[model samples]
Target chain A: AQRVTQPEKLLSVFKGAPVELKCNYSYSGSPELFWYVQYSRQRLQLLLRHISRESIKGFTADLNKGETSFHLKKPFAQEEDSAMYYCALLVPGNQFYFGTGTSLTVIP
Target chain B: DVKVTQSLRYLVKRTGEKVFLECVQDMDHENMFWYRQDPGLGLRLIYFSYDVKMKEKGDIPEGYSVSREKKERFSLILESASTNQTSMYLCASSSQPRGLKLFFGSGTQLSVL
Candidate 1:
């Protein structure tokens, strides 16, 4: 079965520090990966997709097929970056499997 | 920009009562989905509709049912609300070609007493 795993349920980092949100998937075939974010009192929205190969809001994710991972990374963490992040895997059937999500808290 | 609207932002109901959560998308997307968000479980798909009058059971569909009588609207129903059903319900839509890129609405937080 296809599954998306985000091992960390909570993470805290100081401002200006490096941040990385881990995402790993279990799939046999080539996969489409995406990142979604939900800020406080805001609607859930798409952050970025691996296919686009573009960074959104200073964050970028590279799909590593050999490791089956698509970890989100930012060079410098910001206070506004605190939010819930979810990693998703899109399979052949137009279905998405989402990770448990990581709650990121950036301390001042 | 696509807009997916959910009917209610918050709701409270007694156990055993029937509940309906409505969702409508304005982008004329071909697919709509219902999911429940919980603390450790993440977002679990409850049901989804690919077309009018067509519905499919998602990963967790035992306690819920869905109706899609119109192409742009999807409704999620709970036959009898229970405490376990109290959750944050989310509605989303996507087009056929970009089916994985979802547009979501503000979720409805339902509480069953």
Candidate 2:
């Protein structure tokens, strides 16, 4: 069975500090990984995908196949970056498995 | 811009009452999905339709059913609403070749009393 795991339920960091949201997956086949973010009172939206290899809002994620992880990283955390982040894995048949999500709060 | 709209933003209903949550996408996407968002559980797929009149059960399909009579419209139905059924329901749409990118709605917060 394919599964996405986000270990931290809640994380707090100071502004300007490096932030990392951990995401790991359990799948045998080649995986398509994505990160979705939801800010307060806003709709959930796609943050970035591994395939694009493009950074969004200064956030970047690199797929580590050997470690089965696609952790999201940002060099300097911003106050606005505080939000709920979900890691998702897409299977062959259009099925998406989402992680439990991590709530990030960047304190100023 | 792709727009996925859900009929209601917030709803309050009594237990045992039948409930319908409607969703429509304007991008002419080939796939639509229904998901329920909970605090710790994240987003759990309830059902999804790849085409008109075609539906598939998702990770959590119990206590729910779906209808997709039109290509751009998908409806999620709860046969009998229960207190445990209260949740934040989200609707999303995606197109083939770009199916990985999902456009989501504001979500409907439903409360079953």
Candidate 3:
């Protein structure tokens, strides 16, 4: 079974503090990991994909195949970064498996 | 920019009523998907269509069906709406089998009374 797990339901951090949102997956085939964020009163949008290896909004995610993890990280947390983050895994077909999500709150 | 648009922003239906949730994409994407967003459950795929007249059942396809009559339009159908089926329905579209970046709509908040 293919699954995506986001252990932290809610994560809080002070402004300027580093932030990390953990994401783990269990898949037999090659996994395509993605990070999606939803701001308050906004639609869900793609944050980044592991394949692109690009950072958005000063946030980055590294896919550690050895540990089956694709954790999202930001050097410094900003108040605007507070939102719901979702980790998604794409199977062979265009099917997606998303985790429960982690709500990040950056305090000032 | 790729745009996936959902017709209804909010909908209220009685129990056992048939519900139609329409979605249209202007990007001419090859894949379109329907997902339900709940508090604890991030997003659960209800159904997806790869191409026109082609549909596939997603993780939670029960009590739900999908229609893709044209390349730009995908419709999610609920044969009998129930209280449990009430959710924030999201419509998304991706380029192809790669499923790289998914563009999502604002979503429809459905309430089944």
Candidate 4:
């Protein structure tokens, strides 16, 4: 079965602190990972996808195929960056599988 | 910008009532999806349409149905609304099946009374 796993339900860090949201997957096909963000009282939006190899709002996620992980990283957390982050995966020719999600809080 | 728009931002309905939630994407994408958002569940796909008059059941399809009469629009129908079905309904569209982003709507907050 294809699955996406986000181990942290909530993560908190002080301003300017580095942040990492971990994600792992179980699938047989090629990995296409993505990070989505949802701010308070706002619609969920795409942050970044591995295929593009681009960063969005200082956030970047690198796919580690050896470990089946796609961890989202930010060198420094900002208060405005606090929101719900979801890790998702799309196998070759398949629907997207999303994890439970992680609520990140970048404290001041 | 790729835009996916939901017809209603808020709706209130009673049990056993039929409910229609409509969505439209301006980019004329080939795929549209309906999902329900909950506190802990993240997003669960209710149904998806890849083409006009074509639909597929997603992870959770019971007590719900969908329609896609036109390429740009997708409709989610709740045959008989239940209190448990009250959720933040989200509509999404993608450019393609491979390496594409899912643009989402603001969401419809449906309250089944």
Candidate 5:
């Protein structure tokens, strides 16, 4: 079975501090990974995908096949960056397995 | 932008009542999904449809059913709503089978009392 795991349930950081949300996955084949974010009262939206290799909102995630992890990171946290983040893994059948998100709180 | 619209933002209902959550997308998506979001469970897929009249059970489909009569619409049905069933329901759509990105709707927060 394919699974995505986000170990942190909640993370607190002061503004301007570097932040990292850890994620690990278990899959047999090559994986397509993604990070989705939901702001307060906002719908969940895609943050970044490993395939795209692009940064969104100063957040970037790199896929590490050896470790089977795709962790989300940001250089400087902002007040507006506080939100719920989810890690997802896409398998061969167009099925997506999502992690039990991490709630990031950027304190000023 | 792709638009995936869920019919209700918030709903309160009594236990044992049958519930219907409607979702519509204007993006001509080939795949649609229904998921339930809980505080610690994140998003658990209840059902998904690849095409009109073709539905598949997801990770958590025991208490729910789905209908996809048309390509643009997918409906999730809770045959018997329970207090434990109360959660935020989200609907999403994707353009193709290989597409990893999905467009989501404002979730419907359903509370069973």
Candidate 6:
């Protein structure tokens, strides 16, 4: 079965510190990965996708096929970026699967 | 702009009562999904509909049922609301070619007492 895994339950970083949230998936074929962010009192929204290879709000994720991982990274953490991050996968069907999510806290 | 809205932001109901959570999308999406958010479970798909009057069971669909009588509306039904069923329910929709990239609504926080 195809599954998405986010290993961190809570990730804490200081302002201007580099942050990396680890995610690994189990899949045999090409993967379509996405990063979704949920801020306090806000809906979960799409941040970026691996297919687009673009950066949203200074955060970028690279898809590593060999390792079967798509880790979300940011050079300088911001207070506004502190939110619950979820990684999702798209398989052959339109059905989607999501990770357990990582709660990021950027301390000042 | 695409928009998905849940009918209720917060609801409190008693046990054994029938509860209905309504969702509507104005983007004319073909796919709509219902999920329950828990602390460690993240988002567990409860049910989904690909089109009007068509529904499919998700990973955990035991205590819940769905109705998609219209293209823009999907309703989640809980036959007998229980304390364990109290959760943050979310509604999301997407297009067919857009694949699994979903646009979500502000979730409904349901409390069963």
- Evaluated with lDDT, which candidate comes out highest? 2
Candidate 2 Cα errors over 4 Å, as ranges: none
Candidate 3 lDDT over B1-113, as tens digits, reads: 99899979999999999999999999889999999999878899999988999999888999999899999999999999999998999999998757678899999999999
Q: What is the TM-score of chain A alone in each candidate?
A: 0.97, 0.97, 0.97, 0.95, 0.97, 0.97
Q: Candidate 5, A105: how far from true, in Å?
A: 0.6
Q: Which has the greatest DockQ?
A: 5
Residue B98 shift from truth in candidate 4, angstroms: 3.0
lDDT of each: 0.94, 0.95, 0.94, 0.90, 0.93, 0.92
Better candidate number, 2 or 5, judged by lDDT: 2
Scanning candidate 5 chain A in windows of ten residues, the lowest lDDT window is A88-97
* Model 3: per-residue Cα lDDT at residue A70: 98
Query: Looking at candidate 1, what is the lDDT of residue B66?
Result: 94
List-wise, what DockQ does each model earn?
0.80, 0.82, 0.85, 0.67, 0.86, 0.73
Give lDDT tens digits, candidate 3, residues A1-108.
Answer: 449999999999999999999999998787899999999999999999999999999999999989999999999999999999999998877888899999999999
RMSD from true fold, candidate 6: 1.1
lDDT of 5 by residue, A55-108 (tens): 999999999999989999999999999999999998876878899999999999
Clashes of each: 0, 0, 0, 0, 0, 0
- Give the per-residue lDDT digits (tens) of candidate 1, residues A37-67: 9999999999999999999999999999999
- List candidate 1 segments past 4 Å from native: none
Per-residue CA lDDT of model 5 for B36-79, tens digit only, reads: 99988889999999999999999999999999999999999999
Give the per-residue Cα lDDT of candidate 3 at A49.
Answer: 92
Segments of candidate 4 deviating more than 4 angstroms: B97-99
Cα miss at B41, model 1 (Å)? 0.9
Model 3 residue runs over 4 Å out of place are: none
TM of each candidate vs. truth: 0.98, 0.98, 0.97, 0.95, 0.98, 0.97
Measured with C-alpha atoms, the lDDT of residue B77 in candidate 4 is: 98
**Minimal lDDT window, size 10, model 4 chain B:** B94-103
